[model samples]
Structure formats: C-alpha cells, structure tokens
Target: MQKIDYREWGVDTLFYWKLLIGLGIIVALGGLSALYMEHEGHWVTGMTNLVVWGTPHMFAVFLVVAASGALNIASIGSVFGKKEYKPLARLSGLLAITLLVGGLLVLVLDLGRPDRLLVALFNNNFKSIFAWNIYLYSGFMVIVAAYLFTMMERKANFISRPVGILAFTWRLILTTGTGSIFGFMVSRQAFDSAILAPMFIVMSFAYGLAIYLLVLMFTFAQDNRVIGDNLIKRLKNLLGLFILGMLFFTAVYHLTKLYGTKYHGVEYFFLVDGGIYTLTFWLGHILVGMLLPLALMFCPRFSPSRMALAIACGLVVIGGLATMYTIIIGGQVYQLEMFPGMTVINEGYGTEVAKYAKYCPTVPEFLLGIGGMGVALLATTIGIRVLKFLPETLADESVS
Candidate 1:
C-alpha cells in the first residue's frame, strides 16, 4: 500500500483563516451569553412549567439524530460494501462525532443543574426514556469516535469488522432510544404511538443528508474541488426519496390520529384548529419545510446549483427542527383534560378548554439556545483548521 500525504493538496490560506476567526467570534459571544443566563437564572428565558423544555432541547436532539444518520455513510460503506458511499465516509464520520458533542453540550446547559449531569449515570431510571438516551448517546459517541480514529490511521492494515458492525447496530438502537423518549409517553396523545420511533429514524436521514450537502458545498467552494455532476445528481435523487418518505409518514401518522375518535381526536384538533401551534405545524413543518422543498428537489428542470442545494438543505433542517417542536410543544399545548370524554361536564367545554396552554422562551433562554449553535459551529470550524479535519481535495492523499 502507498502512503498518502495530505500536503500535496495546497492549503487554502485565506479561506481557512477567515473561517477560524469567524468561529472564534461566535464562540466568544455564545460564552458570554451563557454566563449571563447562568447568573440571571432560567427566568430570563421564556420557558415555563407547561413548556419545561424549549428550542434548545429540540435542536440538541436534532443534532444528535442527524449525526447518527451521517455516520451511516461510513458504516454502510465499511460493513455493506457500498463503494459509491466511500467518498463521504470520512467527512460523515467527522460530522457525526462533532455534532453529537455539540448536542450533548446544549442538552447539559438546558438542565436545571448543569453540574448534576454525572448523576444521570448513577441515578438509573430504568423506565425513564431520558435516562436511557443519556446512556445510549454517550456509548454511541465513544464507538463512533473510535471507528473514525481507526479509519483515519492509514497504517492500520486490518479494519475492525466487529467495530463497524457494533457502530451500525448501536446507531439503530440509539435512534430508537431517542424516539422512545417521545413515543413512550402514553399520556401524551400526540406521541403515544409506535410510528414515532420509525418517524425519528427517517427524520434522522433527512436532517443528516441536509447537513452533509451544506458542509460538502462549503468544502467544495473553498477548495475548488468539483464533485462530478453524476454524483451530485444521485445524491439529490436520494434526498428527494427521503423527503418523500418523511412526508408520507407524517401524513399517515396524522391521518390515523384524526380518523380515530378518542384522546387522539383532541390532539388532532389542537393542530387543525386555529391555534398558534397549528400555524407552526401547517406553515413551518408542512408547507415551507416539506412540500416546497420536495417539489424543488423532485423537479428535474430545476437547476441544482450550490445555492439551490443550500436552500433546500436549510429548509429540510428547519423542517426537522419543526417536527421536534410539533411533537414536544404541540403535545403539551392542549391540556390532558381537554380530551372529549375527560373534560368536566360542568365546564361544558368552553373557550377555556380550547384555549390550550402557552409557552415562550425568555430572552436568556433564547441566548443559551442560540449560543449552543454558535458553539457547535465554532467547534467544527476550529476542528477543521487546527486538526486539518477537512481534506483540501476530494481525492486528497491524506484522506486515504
């Protein structure tokens, strides 16, 4: 085997420096915001008892789920003998590890006692969905990181087939664990279904692809590397399929809820009725997020430039965020008592019943949530610069 050297592909001096500086600024601002939130308290954010969790949790989960799916490229290529996917293997693995760390950070910051994170490991709640997620996510991160490091070492002759298999298996379990966090809540009509688990798995694919395309485009732009048009076209086609699957699952899930007359009916009404959340579900999740982007991606005549792909990726990412919000926020929007038979007969189901609860994050909460994203971006940028993470060329010898 020939030894591959990365320096052959000349470094992008201007691009790398600018990205590093921008990342530093984001990290500094985010750090300051976090400090302010810590001193002032959770009251600064919009979160209330009704909405105990907010956008930060949603984005954090989104990042982890997306990260797992990104790891699939490497797992599939290594385990399933998929040669076409080899091009994305290294980058996908890197993104998976980086994003998971970022997600974990945001989740910890959201905790009431950020310092009590270790307690999650000791205080085992066998029945709690969140507890299981804590364990699975931590383990999965370790496994993926190990796999990535092994691949990075070109001197290693025998790839650990068992390690690859373990990674692939764990990702599936990890995704399911993530979904069960929502699905196991039988009290919450919005999430009490087996469909949510698979829905999350599919959502992972959508979000992962969106992130991959965005990152790939940026890398290509900076490095002036041309990924063959055929490859780009194939990727777009696959993305289109995933988007369609997501849309299909969404429709079926909601339709089943509406068709059945029970607590689910009331849950459906919360979305269909003229409520603020209904607007978010219909406008943000469906129309703008899924339908429009699907239309663009599926249409052949539409020019698939870097800009177009970026916009589509952005929409899909937003859509994934909205899905989590709809599941978590929309589930709590309507009180449990509001269900048809459960409502008190004396109340006669007045406006109060239909009003549903409200929750908005405070400024400090917003700052923390935004700051988490800033931290993630900063880490990714810095990692690329300091660690020589991103290859200067698609076929750069260093990657091999």
Candidate 2:
C-alpha cells in the first residue's frame, strides 16, 4: 500500500450549487415548522405531557450518535495507522461535524424554549445529567473541529494522531452521556438500566458507519472517482459486525427486562404485543435492518459490486432509524408503571392500568425531523466543495 493522496472533489458545476440550495431550502422549511410549533405551542405538535420528546428526539439522537460513528474511518487511518483508510479520513471528520451540527440543531429547535439555550449553558443544573450533556455535546464539536484541522494542515502533522485519539475518546464519552440521558430516568421502566450507555456506543458504530459508507459511495460514484472494491469490502464487513452487535444488545435488553418478573408486562408490551413497537423491532430493526443487511454483506453472490455495497449501506441506515424509533419512541409508548402489581385507578394519564400510551407525530414534527437530515446533507455538500477532504482516486493498487 502507498501513502494515499488526498484531494478536493473538484466538481465545479452549477448543478452542485443548485443541490446545496435545494437542501438549504428544505432545512428552511423545517425552521418554519419549528416556528409554527412554538407559536401554536406543542398543542399543535404530537408531543403530549406523556410523550413529550416526540419524533425530533429520535432524529436528533440518531444523528448525534451516528456522528460519533462517522469519525471511525478517520480513526482507522489516523489512530490505527491504516494506509488504506487514510484517503477517506478528511471526509470522515467533515461528515462527523456536519451530521452532529444538524442533529443538535434539530434538538435545540424542538426545545420548549430555544432562546433559553444560553441559560442552559450558564444557569446550569449540576445535578442533572441532561444539563451536563449540553457541555459534552459542545465539547464534542470543538474537539472534532480541532481533530479535522490536525488532519488537514501539514503544519499539524506531528500531532494528528494524538488529536485523532483525543477526538475518538471524547466522542465515546459524548455518546455515553447521551445514552445516560435515558438510562438515568428512574421513572421509566424501559430506560432504568446501565445497559443503555454501551448499547448507544455499539449502535453508534453501526449507524455512523452506515452513513459514512452511503456518503462515500455517492460522492465517488457521482464524480467517477475510483473507489476500490477492496476498501468497500473491508468497510462492508465492519458494517455487518456493527449491525449484528446492535441486534445482540437489543436482545439482551429485552431479555433482561423479561428476566425481571415485575417487568413481564413491559416485556410483553415491547416484545410480543406492543403493536408498532413490536413491528419496528422485529420487522424493521431485526429483519430489515440487521438480518437483510448481514445477508447482503456476507453473501458471496453480492460481494463484488459497489452497488451491492450501497444497497447494504442503505438497509443498515434504515435499520438504524428503525432501531432508534423502537428504542426512543417505543420505550415511551409503553407506559410507565405508576404502581406495580396494582391496577392504577384515576391515573389521569389518558390510559388505564396496563395500557400503553399512543402517540403519532404530526406533519410539523415529521418535517422538522427530516429537515435535520437535510441540514447534514447540505453541510456535507458545501464542505466537500471548499475543502480537499476527498481523494481523487482509490484504484485498488493505490489503496490496497
């Protein structure tokens, strides 16, 4: 293997700007949705007193967690000293930051008081893990930017590895903090476990890599760059491993819930008869997200084509979102047991005892959530244009 030559994706065409503008407009519409929600109050949105988080949380958390995973390619090159992955490192860093920014924007926009975001920073609650996440999220962005600089600048070559190492470690902590946001919730039976932190960590790897591969395939194929089959094969194997890991953790989580006799009802709600939760977990997350992608990855019949790799990547991403929906929204849909072993009377939560709560996000919520994705895509398009983040070619000989 040779030292990979990194180069800008020098596609200077009017169509490129049109694409960026188009994405920006979508993000703008999302902004309008957020404003409408704020004006009419959450009464206009799908978020209720019980299901306060809504679809925005699912989208935001997915993007944020995926952001950490997106940096893995860069880490493989910079930290693990893998020459084959080096050419992809810069774009990895750029995607990580952009995806994170996009996710965070959705989160902030969905807040009850977006203007008081500064209050969250200054007027802090030291006891609240949610508050601490504010810093951890910001810190992640800063560290990643620095990490990107170290990669881009020849003057910083001496410290790139160290910076990469730091960014890698920082993102782990960031994702842990994110997962803890739910794990620390004592009131929710679905969330009160130490397992969530590691679950998110592992899920991040799969989600992040899935997004990375999709972006890589598109950019290279669009510009007619030589993305070697060898590199695609290696990344595909890693993606499969992460997808399988997500499945394992999900099983363990539900199984643990089932182990607790008190949580039998909850287990049944999620695992057996929870309707949408069950469908998402079994059909979307497991069958579509995990199994099908794994089949695509390992089956020799599909191994040689980049198109196959792209299809596998798309399935993994879908699975990632499905997994998020089940975990975040499904967990909430299964009502919290106000009193165990006793039928709750006069609960005033719009639900009788042992009954799950129903929530469906409105049009505004959907637009806002999708808008976050648009932001990440738009930022990536712009970043690649101005920066030498992509390599000109990845011919098997050059990258192997």
Highest TM-score among the candidates is held by which one?
Answer: 2
Instruction: List the candidate 1 regions with Cα displacement exceeding 4 Å.
Output: 1-14, 338-354, 388-392, 395-400
lDDT for model 2, please: 0.86
Model 2 misplacement above 4 A:
349-354
How well does candidate 2 score on lDDT at residue 197? 94
lDDT string for model 1 (1-400, tens) is 1232232223477866776677666656656656776677777766666667777777788888888887776776688866555656667777777778777877887777777777887999788878888878889878887777666666652564567788888988988988888888788777788888888888888788888888777766666765656667767777787788888888888888888767555555556772767777887788767887776676566546656767888898887777777777777766565445554444343444335666775565555555666666666665555554454444423233
- Tell me the whole-model lDDT of each prediction, alpha carbons only: 0.71, 0.86
Clashing pairs in 1: 45-362, 46-360, 46-361, 46-362
**Consecutive 10-residue window with the lowest summed lDDT within model 2:** 345-354
TM-score of model 2 vs. true structure:
0.96
Local error of candidate 1 at 7, Å? Answer: 6.3
Q: What is the C-alpha RMSD of each candidate to the true structure, in Å?
A: 3.6, 1.6
